[model samples]
Target: MKIPAANRSFFLFLFPLFFVFHGFVRNARFIRVTDCLVLTGAYFLAALILYLLFYALLRNSINAALVASFVMAFYLFFGFIHDPLRKHSIFLHRYSILLPVFLGLTVLLTLYLRKKAPFTRLSLYLNLLFLLSILYDGATLTWQSLQSRSPRFSTVAVFSEGQPACDTCAKPDIYLLVFDEYTGSRTLRDVYHYDNHGLDSFLEAQGFHIQGKSRSNYWFTSFSMASMLNMSYLNGISHPQALTSDDYTNVWEPLRKSEVVNSLIAKGYDIVNLSPFDLPGHPSTVSQPFIATNTKLITYHTLADYLERDFGYVLQRFIPRASKLGNVYKTNETVISRTIQASSLHPARPRFIYMHVALPHSPFLFDSSLHRRSPEATNVDFRLKDYLDYLPYTNLQAKQLITAIKGNSGGKAVILFMSDHGVRAWHDVSDFSYFFNNQNAVYFPDRGYSCLYDSISNVNQFRVVFNKLFRSNLPLLRDSTIFLQDSE
Candidate 1:
């Protein structure tokens, strides 16, 4: 069968254009204009080979050159897709991208079998769609880069001369409580449909007004905390990639070393860290341990992730044979178990405690005590029970800290509670919202609890909190956000 001249000419013109467009889109992560040119040249070489094959097709020598040309295209595309050679690989952490390698192989086999016009048409359509998408993406990036601006962190001055006076008469310690992956109370009720009755009531009784819609300026723990502690969003850090790159990503470095602690200490305040995960007792003591708060400098963990350091070698060396060993790495279950139980109180100083509560993150079962009562998966599988069991443990920890502070007869307390982000189930990345995504609010997982991820529901958290903290007539705070009637 003879091929049409129009289709042949179209491939000749389209092939090179596709290469240039694809090259730009794929190499943008490397962002350097030099990487762009280099990838363009590499893509041109591959396209040049395909162009020669297109000529051979016109000359009636298509069969001999089919495999060779397809192989060239496969390699060209796979390099970007697989990212075998790039230093800054986006999908390097994800293995799912390998699924397409097999698809490419299938296409290669089809080309070898015959000049399948239908499949070839489908391929051309895919190429055109891809090229247009890349062009649009390039334009968008250009627009954003032009419009990008810097961020500012304003300093908060301390007020009040006499030590904070309260019913306890010790000191009014401001507790910045962050519940990771939690939404405002109303959203829980409206979206998730679970009745969050106790939390709202307890907060009201505690005299802390909740900010239902208090927004988190940054995503993940470090940046959000950086924004929180610095009292600003991270914009001036023009290199927003720094947040993900683990290069001096600490948003709290300046304040950590600054007089935040010293100011309270000067006023006879002892900085207290409640969560064992963030602050273990002391360096030499056997009671508790904390990761050194030098996150500002040690952006990256430097060494391989603990699992890779220990077993990645075996994985890379043996591939499939090390199946029994598995990818499951150290859970730190031992340190974390004794973590909740271990307590060392420093009653003498003004407390500037930072707790990084660990739960709601994977490998679900924190300990036997913090067990998940819900079924594993399917229609009946809900994390409410797991969260229920875990919440008590967390609440128990919160109560203990409050008790300790009151016991000391401390005066004046300011407590702030927040969550970094919501939990992603089945490796779903939908719960995350970055500036690049053009999304104002983050999305929660598929369990159908909309409150945690909904935009409107998060309004009252800190607003209510500050009201209670500053107002002379502090009223009991009640949360109306928990979804009691229906949470998926």
Candidate 2:
């Protein structure tokens, strides 16, 4: 099983490339093409450098390639090995122990490779394995691209057939402001023992009808948002099993190019996306804090992932300056500023502004006076005290945003102030019913709030809006709240 010298060297690069490509294929739906290319190039360059270093040390091509492969495999699969061991026993998973073990293994492997004859058979096996894996992933990626073009579950089909066109109707600038994880007034009173009367009063005084009994259609943000924007439940398209799955490609398609957005575009409304998620012809204004990025996905099962998950707080304590990089408050501030700026602009066509602000969500960044909390204070503990302190700041910002929008639009624009879902990390609360309770409010130019009911859910929010503003007879869906297990 003597393999050519050229073939042995080629497989060294192929293994690292295959690792990156495999990750890209698995998470292609979330990753942008540019991101994938950049990551792949970075991995390839690292592999080349490592191979050269090893070659210089060993003075043997086969030995160098083998050692390089061992190091790359160890680097890539560190988290994969660590996580399972961590679940069983914390002692087995510590970096202090694992690092030395990996180092010892690498040294032993390198020494053995230096002493032995050329391991052409091992090189040939790895080459075939990686080549076959690359081919398989390539085919999967190609098929997914083709499927996206002509999607089997078309979002257009979700809309009601024979819907009336509203070309001649008065199109007011519609503002859909979604405040993430803002619990309903009832949930505030029951779970947190806090009265949200101040914000409720402010909204009501501003001619906004607050849906007191409103709940989110789904527990998760993606599911709730996708259902609302599409004006339909994901009964047939997505099952309970799929809800827990990491692959959200099916959900993302309808979420981005929603039926509601398509309908609005058809009726001559300019889609202004200031949200944290991408939409049709418009990318996200800010990176989504809730979902992992392509880099995070590709680096999953590595030391980077372990540090981020387990020792993030420890890192934040020492490296306080770096904590601002993924601060939720920074993201919220950006969304608010962008929305205010966009509202000030006078577009020729009526605008459908979709602004999703992630506020009052962990890592709890701001306090009542809009001051940034200490890095040590920020946590995912779902503490009521943290949320209580953050709520006032959220209210203040909401008030400011409302005033700006109203002043800019001259009280003529249609504004829908709502939350994607309620506070999900209520660990202390025994009753999980409060998880579904969400904040919902609507403001129409003509004071037409009679159609909006208190118990209306997220799925029916846009339906009511379209019916009211565009004069379309889009039927309101049944208000139902479905709780998915492990939604958090």
Candidate 1's residue-wise lDDT over 1-488, tens digit each? 44333343334334444555544443332233554456456645655565455545434233323443455444445434444433456664343454465557645664554454334554466456656766776786687568644223323332223324344333444454444545445544544454656665665455544445444544444445443443333434444433323223233333343223443454455555443222222111111111223221221122223234334435534552232122211222222323223223434444554444443333233333644322122113335445434555455544455444333433244444456544322232233331111111221112122223223222233323223332322222232221111111
Worst 10 residues of 2 by lDDT: 148-157
lDDT for each residue of candidate 2 in 104-188, tens digit (9 for 90 to 100): 9888887787778777787788888889989999999889877736432344345533678766779889999998889998889
Q: Quote the positional error of residue 100 for candidate 2 in Å.
A: 4.2
C-alpha TM-score for every candidate: 0.41, 0.89
Candidate 2 stretches with Cα past 4 Å from truth are 1-7, 27-30, 143-157, 236-247, 293-297, 312-327, 486-488
Who wins the TM-score comparison? 2
